[model samples]
Target: MSGQNAKPEATPGVRQFTVAPDDDGIRLDRWFKRHLPQVGFGMVSRWARTGQVRVDGKRVKPEDRLAAGQVLRVPPGGESDRPKPQRRQLSQDEIDRAEAMLIARTDAALVLNKPPGLSTQGGTKTTQHVDGLLDAYAGDDEPRPRLVHRLDKDTSGVLLVARTPGSAAFFSKRFSGRSAKKIYWALVVGVPDLAEGEIDAPLAKQPGTGGEKMHVDEENGQPARTLYRVLDRAGNRAAWVELQPMTGRTHQLRVHLAAIGHPIVGDGKYGGQDAFLTGTISRKMHLHARRLIIDAPKDSRGGGGKLDVTAELPDHFAASLEQLGFDAGMSDARPVAEPPRERTPQEKKQAARQHARQYRKARRGERRTRGAPKPDKPGKR
Candidate 1:
């Protein structure tokens, strides 16, 4: 909301940001990952060693905690010069194709109906991607629109792009804080036994799978959750389900659905060939990002309640819906007025005790570290 979208001046040789409220207790190293991810951990350590990275003009260790509203100074060059694959130029055809996908545009954001086959961002062996063509949607004075979130290459629906650096920061905070609401529609092979439920499972990457696949690993996985409601059913064969991932993880929706014995239609990777049907249904993935709602930046338009946007289903998804007798125009079943349950007195007392313990522990650790001797280089020591 600061409207400080202009590029940092060269004279200062640094860029700075005020820590957001949600980041108050996060470590300095994690803060860099949140805001300036391009600056690698190694570079941050080097900067801290050289006294280039500072919080409120005071030198701090990488593990130091950050307070909300404190100013953080970062040297400019690492952000632009960090090692990354050179972005390939987009051909005129690619640019045209990208512009053609634009469904809505605003001063702060752009929404695109991403096609099923297009990758969101480029990578090795990926010559054509949405990131490469974003320039086509930018005006002469606009900064290159930044991808606020990503969808799987085969998943099609509304994709949001931030038009300015301030907007980018604002949306990023919303996402990390779990304040953004995202709805996804998918055709699953079978119906869930219950009308609606939440799946709370932990997920981890499969070893030796090149980090492309995820599996449920209760022992070591990170917590992931999804809320599902069956919207329409076609006998025992297939069902259209609405999924809201409470925690974002790689392939969470796909993995959770499969774990429940109803893998998403055509998600062969997770559900195997059983995920497919013999009829006229397309082999393409049946998942679509249906709707997204988030708070607009405070500095914009009186800081209105929230911005709601819905995306039309892709051609394959729409056709499949029609074939399944599902009404695409149906209203949302989730209630907006669902109030939070009141906590019991015992629960509140336990929560207060837990908070006090953590605060005391963190303070003790900080005191020890503040007076601890700095480690010397291996040879020098």
Candidate 2:
């Protein structure tokens, strides 16, 4: 019962506690789980329903977010009878593997250079993943690091993890707000016609793929955009490119590139047989997250400055780059200042009106020049 988990002594039957800074922005049920581990979620829900739980004298729901310094009131007697769940212990090898991925560490965050083929979260058949490995980063008294964002299983690169609940909320906001910037390096099947351009296609999950595959669907889709710059081309076979996703759509980069007729090398899910490259190129996906730049939490010991980091390319990708005669150093992997925001209908209409006005003024000037009295024949007059 150290840190913010320690509750103040209270009178009989009822207990009162103040929301702590660490628990701020977390749900009420999460607060109970963190501080009063004996109280189950069902009990918390019942308490809220029966008006036994109150925050600042108002009945609060289990999903209500807690703010720092708020006073909480609770009725007693909701300890669970069942044994508490035990966390799985990691072996030495697992700990080593988790530590190996660490590229940058701070009081608020840990940045890992995730290797390919490792899933960010566990799925139905996925027992081992980056989430499960996070226990290795925490000590017995430390809060477990939580993932703020995700990368595809085959897409290797920098992944951010928040070390505390407050930091988790902080980082999540930056990501959702589009304030964080990420740059990716990829090898595509063919060079694009335009060396540098933006892909403004909308994306939707393909109907038959059970939401696992995405495709361009202008009629019914979410707006998705990606900025791509070709670094170098190895004849017509392959090209090295830098990619910056303007939107966080699932499989956005893969789908957009594939839709434009150039799929990343070895992205069989989107490109099928055409995704593969011949001669010494590994069949693993060639996309890798290269750099991430984001603001640190306010309470971070590192003066709350930006956390900028770059991950080295994975072995297969590096080997492929060398084999293709493409220089990885040719391009600096800097993210664009901002993603291009889509203009509203009113703004578009205004722009069109202004263009029409300019066109009409030019036309009137041309008519006046043609009608002028021919300048009286100059010297002859």
Candidate 3:
């Protein structure tokens, strides 16, 4: 139990630079967006929101005007704000197989399933991520594609990527207007009293730490809405739930679930419990991206119904459900590689404690011997 809350040291990085001219007094976020053309504006907004992108060793607001020569530290592990040389790695055969999941493809867009634990893009100093293998996924397409939205590092589900700049603009507009429906499945700590209800808690970035959490901010927060329903009850301690996010704020579902007193188990950051370490079911939040419904661009030649894409539970989630009584080989969207499971020494210690408790109970039962001695004593008396 000791030191369970300790966070490791920050990832190491060195200073990098892109100078802002005197005339570039534009919003700090906007300025970064322009100067760092490769990085997404939202990534910059996130850094500003979280205080990672600071000015003069202090945090700067998104719209804060920039003064020339203010020192900035670009942290390690950003997918968007990093630069690297181009190279080819995967063979042609590998590229074909990975692209087989394409539900819809055009010169401008291609919607695909993004497996859990795959970062949307590569980092400044990263070894492997979803974006790291773009050569295999994107095939021979020049200039490649870009991710429009990101699932959490451990969330397995549908991800939308735009193949062209024009398509990227189209998809971005749809997302901004909330025209897309994002549905998810999460196994939570306990069942809610209501079968179906909406949680309309405003969420603000968790205080004290930057970008680490989202808390229920009654005041000084942005509007966020999440619609949820109990899918099925799991014994007494947990329940399977469905989530429909009305707003796409970071950690919105995780925060809303926590605010209502039912944090997603194994979600140590927001769910904040280390209980899942005991069973083979490590990382038990059980949240799956499940499905996404978005309005595909009306064809340049004509038009039709909205585009739908679904990514099934990766192997780990599937295995967990089977262990918990979900039917084996049940219907799912897609099959993905599972996260590697490891048994930590701490988990072994917890298991040992359980065995000791069972041993003591057995010893007590042996001593009682039901009515064996009691009857003889009564007769003697």
Residue pairs with backbone overlap in model 3: 312-334
TM-score of 1: 0.67
Q: For candidate 3, lDDT tens digit of each residue in 305-380?
A: 5777677676777776666665523333333212224336565345434433443454455467653564566657
**What stretches of model 1 exceed 4 Å from their correct place?**
1-90, 299-305, 332-381
Segments of candidate 2 deviating more than 4 angstroms: 1-20, 25-30, 40-78, 300-302, 333-337, 344-381
* lDDT of model 1 at position 147: 95
lDDT of 1 at 79: 63
Best by TM-score: 2
Pairing residues by index, what is the TM-score of model 2?
0.76
113: Cα error in model 2, Å:
1.2
TM-score for each model: 0.67, 0.76, 0.59
* lDDT (Cα) of model 3: 0.62
Q: Report the lDDT tens digits of candidate 2 across residue range 1-381.
A: 223533553567787788765566789998888767889999999999989899988999999998877888888789988676566799999999999999988878899999999999999999879999999888777777899999999999999999887788888999998788889999999888889977776678889889999876655777776888888898888889889887899999998787777889999998878799888799999999999989886552225779888898999999999988877776764445465567675754554344335435644765797798856666785
Q: State each model's CA lDDT, in order.
A: 0.77, 0.83, 0.62
